[model samples]
Target: MKHVLLATTGESPQVVTETLFALHQEHQPWPDALYLITTSRGQSKAREGLLERGHLARLCDELGVKQPLFDNSHILVVPDANGVPVDDARSLEDHEALANFIMTQVRNLTADPQQSVHASLAGGRKTMTFYLGYAMSLLGRQQDRLSHVLVSKGYESLADFWYPSQQQGQLHDRQGAPLLTAEGKPLIASAATVTLAPIPFVRHRQSLPAILPQTGESVHFRDVVRLINLGEQPEALRLQIDLAQQLITVSDEESDQRFEFKPSLIGLAFYAMMARATCAEESDLTRPSKKRADTALLKVFLDELMPLCGLQSCADWQTGLKQLLDWSELKGQVKDNTIDALNGGIPDYWFDQRKSELRKLFEQKLPLTVSRWLSPEIIWAEDGALLEQPGSTKGGGYGIPLARKNIEIINC
Candidate 1:
């Protein structure tokens, strides 16, 4: 298995060299690959000190260690709320963005089973380290490792000190003052000692259900924590899909709290269909296929979908679904159920698209915890492979964990 070294750094880019120094010279040596996470200013320090000045290369060359695959691409600059790299993480929005970025990075690396990640919590702000640590707890596998590098006390935070080099006789502090020994001899880089401290962290992935983390490019910190901490939600809240107003409403009887917001048309359909099925206490709905058309599936879809049409506020979606299904109009209303299948069926891409987009919508609009509670948990195939079965419980279709009594579909 390829060992990957991932580190979070701040103004002190030396952490990278320190970590490599403490690990690479002897035991476990340099990783097969290396990655760094830092802010805009931090990236500048890393670029200048580690790359431009050739410090990283020099350290490896002198230590007789093979360099790992790394460059500017491996240096991930933490983006701000606007998706722009920020000099520092300070604002509330910046912190949230940082957390999401860190989570995304961690999840992406861990998603690959072939690679074992060695995460270095040796740099960056406390919040950055905390987020990285928590992400490891949530997604880290047995092969994964977490650590923080400890530098000799006097050598810590010294800008000029990347790693101790016996070639240099004197080192300067951040203020540019020469560091010297008690005998008045100039301090050499060899005076610094760096050690790796392995931190034992609880791996929650083994204990929790696989679906809780929401596999994809991004996951919000609040949602994951809430999902893990607040597992098996209480049944006091009811959900509503207001077709007329194009809104999904959540009301709590015990707390007397109500939340209302509009969702994407496709997401609306997928969710509303499931909500309708639950209310009727019907069987699980099968996923739409991308390849061949199944009349039974189309009919079942229209049966729940047609009732949602005929509203002025929902016209935009009406037109979209019309085009999607290649339908000029239904043969009759949802009650008649005689809509003929002019074409084979709608593309299954719509189904997958809805799954991803709908989850994002819920994550963006609903309460952090409530969003996960309302998401459609799909048992997606490994690749583009379509699941052949129909029932949600068996892993081939869509499943909503909510009970029948909790869903209320309001027609236009």
Candidate 2:
């Protein structure tokens, strides 16, 4: 199997050798090939420090290790929208391009079944390190790894420092001044300390859908990481719908936190109906459908909502049901003459509008952070939706994607 070391670098190219040294000390498998993602300036610095000065070859020779396949060709310079190599990732456009370039490289490398990648985020700008780590999390295989090399404070950022040599070697400062030990002797590379800390991440490459590049469409690296993190979150949360109090409570067993939401009666009813549908094994109920609302279904929903609405009498429930059923008639669009069509029927447009209103109400009542995690469980998209697939159907509807065991209906 081919082992590959993937790293991101900025002006300082010593991270490559530092990481290599740490891995060797830890008795980890050394990479057979090295690939560096950087900007134009970074590429030049790497060439000067590692290749032009023979630091890379010297480190390998001093350590008595086989040199990996790395050269100018292995250095990937991030390009801008115009295909011109970017000098630095200081602008948002540069960062986006850099992210895309990193993702593409990770995807291509992980495509080979026999390849194992070791990603080092010890170099480059902060954004570069972030993007590389995120890309690895997205596409990394079980055999793949992520790490950041840590060098002792004094040895870090030193111009002449590469790897800790076995024999005594001269170490110089940025201005070429000899760095001395406490005894006044010239410091050697062996005095430097290096450690490689492996990073743990949840890989969702297989779970993510194929993201084909579209002309006007783009995927943000952060958005992808957020989604993968959400998917990997343990299903330890449950929602308790207290219809009598017109409140929804989200309980997270893992965090031992509880969030409460007080929505309008209509919003609460709508949410309850969706929750009921999801629990009853009705798939795709969380999605909005163009199909008109069935009168029978509407009647069942109203019946279920009456007790929650605090209707004291049958007459009150009947009046509320009549008001909803008469919406189409009031709009002067009476298509069907049957009692079911007149009393319980609802237009698809009207249903969708009501759902949108309910969603807005719920969102307004819930905390922003909590709402993000709960929106998919509450709001149903009309089109182009990407959410958890607990179940599916040809016709869309509104429902949560949670297991029935996690939902509880209290106080009727």
Candidate 3:
């Protein structure tokens, strides 16, 4: 009789799917019982407690992998005083306990004196993988067994595997054909050097060496990276400005007019409302500055605007703005009269208050301005003279104006 044990942490669905495929391939020749060992962290979740463990469990069940409902008979999931599971115990101790539990369970399965055990380490975090492998080592199979599956070039999608640095900046086809040279190959390939990082496999006592390699002489177009984060680099600001200048040079204003003046009106409205609300609370405009207003705008946009616009799923601003606005509240405000309560004209105060409130909302809700490769420098002044604006710079804060389009400063 053969017992095949597959250990995993179940952190990602991709891991589970890949492991299942590999298990089915390996177990094709013989009749085998399956054992799934998952750490506490491997449990899959759906939307933060709405339905936590069901998603991954169902996935496993669909693949015909079987396991008991609980980890073992001795331990149960009991709630604390706050009704939360305090599962943070000794990691190594938990591994030993689990190993003992598995050994006990397998003992009751068959009466055959010559039983062979096969263990596969395919998924889970590094620590979990190491612990499971350690347990399996102690169990010690008496047959042909191996800890890791050796992958070549095509198996890039494997859980923790990575290509060597010597292969970096090189594009390979599915059949492992070189697509481009790593160094500068203008049209089809640009010869360039790319650094690859080493992957640590503590369980198997194996590590890959770092390599930086040059590719061949062709740019297969498929080798290009579509998305990259420039992060907080000043070079990002220059890149965007360069791109904009290039666009302006190649395309006439008449041809690209459609893309030019579509200022973020909803973004503007959000900032306006925040600034207005905070300014009304205190007679001083300094009380609700642009930075503060931007922060507030971000909060409302994330918590309220995205949900109301039915764009919560995507969290994209373009989709949010395209949704229809009822404008019912604006109409109601227009009809109401609260002029005598304020010495300043109510209409004027209302407009100013609304603008400031929107500004405050954006200041609060929007992410802090940072340099990105696509960020434009048309708005920011170089000498720091334009840094100071309308509001108070009292508390280690820089002033930003609510009405200006170029308030973003990418100093990085």
Clashing pairs in 2: 285-397, 285-398, 285-399, 286-399
Q: Identify the runs in model 2 with alpha carbons over 4 angstroms from their true place.
A: 182-185, 210-412
Q: Which candidate, 1 or 2, would have the higher TM-score against the true structure? A: 1
Candidate 3 per-residue lDDT over residues 1-412, each given as its tens digit: 5554344434433333334344444553222444444434433221121124343344345445653233332122222233343233245444444444333333332223254544445555454455445434333334423244333333334222222222234555547665532343321212221122222222211110011011222211111110111122223222111111211111112222111111133333233333333323222222233323332323333333333233342344333323322222333321113212121212333334544543343223111222111211111222233323323234222222322322231111
Listed in order, each prediction's TM-score against the native is 0.59, 0.55, 0.26
Candidate 1, 1-412: lDDT as tens digits = 8889999999888998888988864486358888999988888888888889988888888888778888899999988888999888778998889898898898888877888999999999898899999889888999999999998867788877888776665898768899876677776788878888999999876554444345575776765554444434637667888877778886666554565667655457667876765566444455655466554545555544555564222234334345434433443322222222324454455556666776666555343455555676542233323333222333344545565577777876
Q: All models: lDDT?
A: 0.70, 0.70, 0.31
Off by over 4 Å in 3: 23-31, 45-114, 149-412
Error of 2 at 85 (Å): 1.2
Query: Candidate 1 regions off by >4 Å?
Result: 174-177, 182-185, 207-216, 236-412
lDDT of 2 by residue, 174-229 (tens): 78888987778878888788999999999766555344112234445544544344
Poorest stretch of ten by lDDT in candidate 2: 209-218
Shift in Å, residue 127, candidate 3: 3.1
Which 10-residue window of candidate 3 scores lowest in summed lDDT? 204-213
Clash number for each model: 2, 4, 61
